[model samples]
Target: MKKTQYSATRVDIISGHLTEVVDDLRLVDVADYIAFIRCELFGNIADIVNSATELTFYPDTLTFGLGGEYTLDWNTAPKVMLDLEFKNMGVNAYFRLTLGADSTEIDLHHVRFAETGRSPADNTALLAAAFENARLPQLTASENLG
Candidate 1:
């Protein structure tokens, strides 16, 4: 059975409903995903530092939804670090989004989630969780708020 290497486009982003298969994302996909999430949560994707291979978003606050247990207040440590690295893996290229000082990698090359599938709303929730997970530790340590 042949697997599909879906191009990371705006439509793909929307079709996935913001619940992207982290392992199937391209570099641009990561940027678009973040932009989408930010837009959904904060109303717009302004002042977002974007480049060919990287992106940086300094939002005023990172809020989880009504059910979210995590929130990162920007008053103390304003920057929630998210770095995307484009790499050549010999057979193919890989896009990796490394979050925070620990560099916890979210590999978009895995086929697990892509095989199972998730709803658009679920995808959004996943991104939100990833966003929260990325900054929770720092916020917890610096401001003592999680």
Candidate 2:
């Protein structure tokens, strides 16, 4: 008998829009915080990537201000794959998230800003800062489900 793989579908359970200007080092901090939020929503980075197959939320997770007014179907246009949307010094920013080869690693496949006022170097620096600050959530024993 052959074993069947059980793949899970990921859903857009949460979304956030910037309420304040995020620039300088704050941009990185916000990115890290969002990453932590993702880990909290899912058991791990792998679970988040596998989310395309399944959408499950962690028990008692706090996701304040992350819920958007609308939700897009997983296969519809303007899909709900965006993990973050922020404003950097007034520029509309976004991130498309993906998982790295390592099950524990989460990568931001795309980072785009709606405005074109900043130079390429400035944007790169901002993104690098975000990646540097990104950290996985370290859930407590009680919070960690088997």
Q: Which candidate comes out best when scored by lDDT?
A: 2
Q: Estimate each model's TM-score.
A: 0.21, 0.24
Residue 96, candidate 2: alpha-carbon lDDT: 43
lDDT of 2 by residue, 1-146 (tens): 11112100011111111111111113233334345454554233223333322222222121222321212345632212224333333333333432222211112223464556776656655544433233234467888875
Mind giving the per-residue lDDT tens digits that candidate 1 earns over 1-146? 13333424312332232223222233233345444555554222222322211221123222111110111365532223232321111111123333332223333432122323676455434444434333312243657653
lDDT of each: 0.30, 0.31
> Looking at model 1, which ten-residue stretch has the lowest summed lDDT?
62-71
Error of 2 at 22 (Å): 20
Candidate 1 matches the true fold with a TM-score of 0.21
